[model samples]
Every structure is written in structure tokens, then in C-alpha cells.
Target chain A: MKLTDLVSRELVNLHLQGSTRDEILREMADVLAANGRLLDKDAYLDAVFAREQEGSTGIGFGIAIPHGKSAAVKTPSVAFGKKPEGVDWNSLDGEPAHLVFLLAVPETAEGNEHLKILQMLSRKLIDDEFRQGLLQAANVDEVMALLETVE
Target chain B: MISMKLLAVTSCPNGIAHTYMAAEKLSKAAEAMGVDMKVETQGSIGVENELTAEEIAAADGIIIAADKTVDKSRFVGKRLLEVAVSDGIRRPEELIRAFSEGDVPVYGQGQADAGSRLKTIQEIKQARKSRQNPVYRHLMNGVSYMIPFVVVGGLLIALSLGFGGHPTAHGMAVTPGSFWDHVLQVGTASFSFMVPILAGFIAVSIADRPGLVPGMIGGYIAANGSFYGSTAGAGFLGGIVAGFLAGYVAKWIKTWKVPQMIQPIMPILIIPILSSAVVAAIFIWIIGHPIAIVFSDLQSWLQSMQGASKVVLALILGAMISFDMGGPVNKVAFLFGAAMIQSGQYFIMGPIAVAICIPPLGMGLATFIGRRRYTKDERDAGKAAFAMGLVGITEGAIPFAAADPLRVIPSIMIGSMCGSVIAMLSGVTDHVPHGGPVVAVVRAVDNVPMFFVAILVGIVITALIVNLLKKEIPADEETEGVA
Candidate 1:
């Protein structure tokens, strides 16, 4: 239920090469697939797209958490993508996003478990040091290690 | 030689946006025409930059531009020009020119004969007031009663899902025989009355007691599509049409010759029957097919839309949510999502959920990120609105939009629409009728992470747009030197 348990080094994309929201989502879906955490990339993408329709997960402060629960997911997992050049995500403060957290949860997980993970991630992200460390994290391993501290 | 100052006042019902816009335009136009004008804006907190009694007494002319009632007793003895707020917004220059050309007439004095225009304005007001037939009054009454049903039904359905439903292999399903299931159904039944109530009231307003029977019957037909060859029928919109048809039919029938002794019975029997017959016939034969086609097309379009299709959908939902805040436009979108939930399409509600929260959430975030863009009152209201957004309340954004509609509406719309599209493209599905961050947290959202992302994106977009759009008031202007 926690970020450290749900996220792995393989799930992190250090540099997102895509320019558009779709390309980023596709790349994120692929990461979930590569980690064996997703059964169907298409379904996972559908879940992601569906969630986006409700509203952006960007709660502001240059951080975005995009998460979904779908049958396409083989297991509950989290994928971290950092866009240094800052994609035009239209952040609340008019700032481009530097840290992106894409969470892919199993469709059947207990509702409380999902909330626990979001609470953990949101609380930690609000801290200046925690977000700064995550932003400066040189690689996926560093990001994963930092997330483990929260766990 | 004697000279006099010209004073003008502008106001609208809500006392925001249009009121200020009209004031600004009028002031600018008056200045250009060399008219010494001091315009006061009556907004939510009452009047701002008020004119003194001496100034009013010295004015040779006065213009009152308002939709709501303005106290004209103060200017009764002066040369006054009265016009609708729309005329001020659309024709400020012409209004000023008319005043300069001495076209406005004096009132409340021996010179009343000199101001023919004043008599015409009075006649117009009288005509407008007299034109309000019983049908309009009854319709408004019905609508007033009906809104609570829609809100309660929609909110209860959403709450039931949030508290009771669990994700299943076949998507979200309520367990059979659950307490919440009963509650949910009860809520849905309340919503079912929305159309009937709307139509019935409109008729009652128009024709008084005579309009009630036909209105209710017409409303029933509108709600039930089997009579019209459609599955969903015309919904609330159909109710409106039915109400009008029934009212007019009943009114027409009232003119028929009956025994003078039976005149009282005519309203109870003949009018209701004739009106109901007309409404039923129209729905079954004339209007049914087109309404069915439109309803089916809407369903098909929603079902067929995929990934990229969300962008357009988001734009529309966002526009609706922000257009009038919680007014008719917002109701239309909200009702569309609720209807879709009954039809087992959860994805259509996805974008709507996102659109509903973005306005308040985004404004709340703006207050935290930047303090200069908002007034003290706005920042305070933003805090409360933020909490409202978590519960998926769209009315929370009304205060901000009212304060600066031109700038705020567009900002929230762009943000909300962007978030909505992203949610759609992400394939997020919401089984519930209502939306909010709280709903997502309660496992009401299918794609939890994408729900977060969608909200985050929306918050960012709204904040950015609002910040960018806000015109900064200079700091120096805030502090004036004191000797």
C-alpha cells in the first residue's frame, strides 16, 4: 500500500522523451508492462485516460500524481517519470511539472489500501526536502531508495 | 450660464461580472464624450464609489441601467433615463449620445410632458410586468421545487456508491439487498420526477389552476419515451415543451362556449383533457422520432469515443461547468452524467467529475502559490471552496467567477477542460453520479492514480491560467503618501 512497496526501480522513467500527454501515458504504460505489473497495456492506458477525464492529478507545486485502478493491471504498482524540460502540464501555479508519479493499481484492491498509498505519497511530497530529493534523484535506483524511506 | 453633472448607475441581478463590465464601459464612453459622469457599481457587497447627495442634486441627467429593481424615487424629480443592463453593455455610446442630445425627458414635475422618452420607458416596464402570464409563474415555481430533487438524488446516488459499492469483475456493482442499494434506488426515483415537476410547474405558472393537469400529464409523457418511440425520451427538456403545449392548449380551449353555469367546471375538465391530448399527440406523432434519434446519437457518441476523443469532450464539459457556475449549463452537464450512470456508462461521468472539481480546487491552489492575484475576500473564500471541491461541489467556484467572470471563468474552464480530457483519454471510469477528490479516495474511482493525475493536471492548469490572466494592481497604488 505504500510507495516503496508499490514502486520498483524498473517502473521509473528517468527521462520522458515524449512531448504530448498521450506519448507520456504510452511510455508510462510500457513501463508498467515491462515490470510485469500490467496484464494489458491497452486496458491500463484506458484506465489512465479515463481518470484524466475527471481532472488532472496535478495538485500543484510542480508535482503530478496520475494513478488508476483497472483489470489491465496484473498487480498494484507505481511508475515515476521526471520531465526536466517540464511538459506543459498546466500546473496549478502555472509551472511545468518536474515530478510525475503514475500509479497503476489492481482493479480489485481494497479501497482503503489505495487511499493509504495516496496519503503516504501526498504527505511525503508536500515536504520540501522529500520532493527536492526525488527531483534531484540521479537514477531510478535513487528514486526507489528515497521512496523506501517513507515506507 | 448653468451647467450640471450627469450621473449614471449600472447593476445586474448577481451584482458581479456584467455589472462591473457595464460600469467600466459606461465610464469610459462618458469620459470620451466630455460628459462629467460618476458611475456607481452595485455588486455583492453593496455599492462602491458612491456619489454624494450634493453630486446627485447637481446632476442635470441620470441614467439607470439595471435588470433588477432600482430605487427611482430619489431621481423622481430629475431628468432621468432608464434602460436595461444589456443596453448599457451593448450600446454605451448611444446611451451617452442620447443624454447629450437632450433626448431624455424630465419626470415628477410640471415638465413631465417634455420627457416623452420617460413615458415610453415606464410603459415598457409596465408591459413587461403585465406580460408575465400565469404559466411563467407556475413554471418558475415548479423549477424552484424541482432543483432540490435533482441535487439530492444526484448527491445521494453518488454517496451510496462511495460508501457501499465495491469493484467487481464486471466493474462497480452494488451488492443485492444491501441497505445502500435501497437508498440509491430511492434517490434515483426522486430524480425521475425532475422532468414531470419541471413541466407541471411551467404550466401552472402560465395557466394557473387550469394549467396543472395538462402540465403534469405532458410532463409524464416527456419522461416516458415508449409513447414517443425513444428509450430515454426527452428528459427535463421534453417536460418544458409538454408544459408549454399543455398550457397553450388549455388556454385555447378556455375560450370555447360552454354553459355559463358550467364555466367553473371548464377549467377542471375540458382544459386539462384537451391540453393533455395535444401534448400526448405531439410527443407520440410529431416530436418523438427526432428526440429519440438525438438521445441515441448522444449515447452512441459517448460509447464510441476513445483516447483522443476525450479532448473535445473535456472542452465541452469544462465550458459547461464554468459557463454559468452552477446555473442551467452546469445542470445540463451534471444531468447528462447522471443519466449515463443509469444507462451503465461510467466513462462519460469521468470527465464531468474532473470538470466539477477543477474550478474550486484550482482557485484554492492559486491562493497558496500566489497571494497577489486574489483579494483578501477571495483568498478566504478560496479556503472554503477548496474543501467544497473535495466533495465535488461546483457551486464553490461561483464566488470567484462572480468576482471576475471574464478572467476567472475562462481560467477555470481551460483548466477544468484540460483535466477532463486527460481523464477521458486515460480511460478513467467513475460509477458514481457525483465527483470530488474524496470520492476518488473512497475507491469510487476506477483508476485511482489517473484520478490523482487528472486532478493534479487540472489544478495546475487552472492556477496557471488564473495567475496569467489576473491583472496585477500596482503595490504603489495600495499605499498613498500621507502628509
Candidate 2:
């Protein structure tokens, strides 16, 4: 159920180039797909868009957790992207999200372990100190180390 | 020890991050505020940390934050705040603070009329936990349990008489040894259990299992006129006396420092026997005769009222029936009407029939016309109340009165009084023991048109007066948890 177990160095992007919400989502989804966590990027993106339509995943504090549970997902995994320039996410606080965690969970995921990890991530994001740590982390290794502390 | 406890439910359309996030944030906020809170998360993994009935009953307030539909029925009678899931996450402290500020609306007001019977009973029991004296609490516990028996007996008796009884010079009477006669007997059997069950449960609430035998035995003695040397039995009032006496006597015996050998047998053998004997003896020798005398005297006084002004009698009966809506006062008025029917004074029962239906009918109309004054739940209950009123079930108004006694009780009392006065003035006569339009349909009522007119006037008065007295439900409460 550890957040570190759902993410890796290859999934971490310190400099995300997306200038808009859709571009950020696509960039992060590509990271998940390249890491062999998604079978069909288009289908997974559709699920994320559908979730966004109900309510935005941008839960203020400069954070957005855009997630999708679809059969197109190959494995339960998370892609971390930092857009320091900030992107509009329709957040409750009306702040652009600088830290984004694109979560991919398979429709046929075997157990609740991945969901529990997602819960831990959601809770950790609420902590001001933890968000600061995520924002200040220098590299992929630093990001992984900080996420491991969530357990 | 925490004085306040809160229950919360969190759900989202995606059933993943938001559900758990809201739960976590709420939990953290409650902890920081030093209030006990339990959050049930309806997430992707299904419901976790689900609240139990006992916990829900004991909670001071509730918060429901969900993007998707969540059942609010279970939180009936609780001070509740509902908001979007995003508000739950971003403003958890503010949500909990609403309860402290006492701004939250009580959820499911008047829902007892539309909700499940068991849930209504449970809500009543929970509501009784606060601001009630120990004696009142114990007595109410007994009454709550005794209500079903009373309704069953009352409805069955009404059914048998309505369907099979023939009006004669004496009164309504069923054929001897017939199906309806057996049904009447069955109804009587259920009525016989009412007092005993009331006493037994009261004792149980006070002294636990050891008090049951004595309470029931004492109640039986109280209800039997032979032991008390009067024509009338002691009735429910005397039953209450017996229950308290037996309960306290049993509780007192448990405090005695007995030998080890006898201590083990005290609850099962010694306590039951001694308490039962003590209660039975006390009632038979001291209080029972007085109670029976009062009961009989009250009956005689009511009978004597026949020659007096019918308006005054109708006014008194109407006030009593609507005052508590199936409580002790209501029972007295109802029994008086039933007794009058036995004496072939059908006109006395006529006003009672009208009075009995007015409270429910009036409350139903109040909700209908004053939609802004009542919550959605109350409006739903109003529909059920209207249906019950048609069938003469006065208990349908219990939820409305319970929810807002100040406005609702006075309005219903005035309504019943108006209806009863009209029925008396018109000389409406009811042959059967039942009230409502159903009795008229069964050909048991004379001047059916007047009976309906009385009810209609009463209903309108209640609706208008209650609406005038009650403030409108705030716009936020009416909105529910909008996404």
C-alpha cells in the first residue's frame, strides 16, 4: 500500500512542458504509457476526462490528482509531473496546479492495495509540509524518497 | 470524556481519491477540535469503517459529503449538515464548526410518518436520551414498546366492528360465536398484553432482567378490579405505578449484602419472588384500591357529562385526543367514547371520531400548503399522514408533533377542537368504535356530509395556523448536497 510501490524514477518528470490542463494530462499519461503501465492511452484518457466532467481532480493547494480506472491500464501506477509555470485545473481555491500526479488503475486490478496507496497519496497531499517537500525536491531520487515517507 | 460525537459519510462519483480524502480531512479536523468523529468512506474498495446503529444513535450530529447520491434516511432526527465533497476536503473544519454553532438543521424532520416503523421507534428512543428525567425516560421506554400491541388491538377491534357488527337499540353487536366474535376476542387478548408488557419493559429499563416477573405480575394485579375492590380496573396509570414499584424494589434488593451462597440465586430466584410479592402486596393493600376508585370515578363523571352541554364535552375530548396523539390522555378520551358507544350514546362517539382524524389530516394539509415551512422529508411524511387520516390513524401525526411540539401540537389541538365542535353541533352519530371517513363508508355514521365538513374546516385551520407560526426552512437546508 506504499505510494513508492506505485511509482518509479522513469515515471517522475521534474520539468513538465504542458502549458494547459489537457496538455499536462496528456504529457503525464504518456509517461505512464511509456513505462508499460497503460495498454491504450486513448481509452485511459477518456476515463480521466469522464471523471473530470463530474468534478475536477484539481483539489487546490497547487495539486491535481488526475486518475483513471480503465481496462486499458496495464498496471496500477502513478506518473508524477511538476509544472512550475502552473496550469489551470478549475480547483476549489482557484489556484493553478503546479504538482500533478496522474494515477492509472486497471479496471480489473486484483486487490485494494493500489486504492489504499492512492488514499495515502491523497491524504499526504493535504499536508502543507509534504506539498512543500514535493515542490522543492531536486531530482527523481528526491521525489521517490519523499513519497516513501508516506508509508 | 468527549461530550460531543459526530458521524460522517464521504462518497464521490469516482469512488477513489475524494472519498478517502474527505474522510481523512474530516477526521483530522474533528480531532483538532477535540470532538469524537467517525467517518464512513464509500470508496472504490467499498464501505470502510461503516457506522453501527448504536454509534449513530449516540452521535450529536452528522455530516454527509458526497458527489453521488447517498442515503440520508439513517440520519433521521439528527442535527445534520450536508455539502459537496470538495467542501468536505477544503472546509472540513468549517463543516464540523457548523454543529458547534448550532446552525445545522435536524435531518429527516417528521420522517417517522414516511420512514420504517422500526427506524421511527429507534429515533424516538434516541431523542429520548437527551433532556429527559430518569423516570420519564424509563416510562417512555415502556410506552414505545407497548405502542405496537395497542395499535394491533385497536385496529383489529375496529376492523371486526366495522365489518361485522349490527346496530341495535343497545349498541353495535356482533353475532355470538361467529368469526367476528373470535376476532374481537383476539383483539381483546392483544389489549390484555399491553399493560403487562408496559410494566415489564419499564422494570427492565430500571432493574434489568430480574425485574420482569415482578413488573408483569404487579401490572396484572393493577389491571384486575377483583384484587382492588372496584368495578373498573386501575388502567395504564396504575400499570405505571406497578412497574416503577417493582423495578425499584428489585433494584433495592440487589444492593443488599447477602451471603455468598444466596447471592448467586438472588437475581434468578430470590429477587424475582420477593420483588413480585412486595409489589403485588403493596398494590393490593394500599394503592390499587385508590387507583381503581379514581378510574371508576372518572368513568362515572364522563357518563354524567351526557346531560351537560355537548360543546364542552366535545371540546375536552378533542383537546385530549390531539394533545398527545395516542398517549395516556388520548387513551382516556378514546376509552370514554368507546364506553359511550356501549351505552348506545353514539353521538358522543361521533365527535371523537372527527377529533381523532383531524390531527393527521391537518398536519398533512399543513405540509402541502406550507411547503416552504417544512423540509422535504416532512412533506413526504405529509402524504402518508393524509392517507392515515382517511383511515382514522391518529398516530400518523406523532412524528409531526414530536418534531415541533410548540407549533404542531397547539395547531392540531385547535384543529381537533374545531372539528369536534362542528360534529357535536350537527348531532353526528357514529355506531361503531372507529373514527374517520372509513366508518362512514361502513354505514356506522349518521350525517356523513356534516362529518366531512367538520374534518375539512379543522384541516384548513390547522394548516393555516401552523404555517403562520412556523418559520420557513432555510434555502441551504432545502438544497441538499448539490455537486
Judging by DockQ against the true structure, name the best candidate.
Answer: 2
For candidate 1, write residues B1-483 as lDDT tens digits: 123367888876544234554676677677767778888767543677776555665688888888676665446556888887656655778887776678888756333333424343433222222333544444445655565565566566556655776654333456778988987798678767767776777777566678888888888888777887776556555677788887777777877888889888787777788778887888888988787776666555544543445567667776776665554456557667777778887887888888888888898888767767665555665776676577676655655664456777888888888888888888877777777776677566788788879888998989888888886533422221100
lDDT digits (tens) for residues B398-430 of candidate 2 = 656644568889999999999999999998988
Chain A fold similarity by TM-score, each prediction: 0.89, 0.97
Cα deviation at B220, candidate 2, in Å, is: 13
> In model 1, where do residues sit more than 4 Å from their true spots?
A1-151, B1-139, B168-173, B299-310, B313-416, B424-439, B442-483
TM-scores, each model vs. reference:
0.40, 0.49
The candidate maximizing lDDT is 2
Off by over 4 Å in 2: B1-4, B108-483
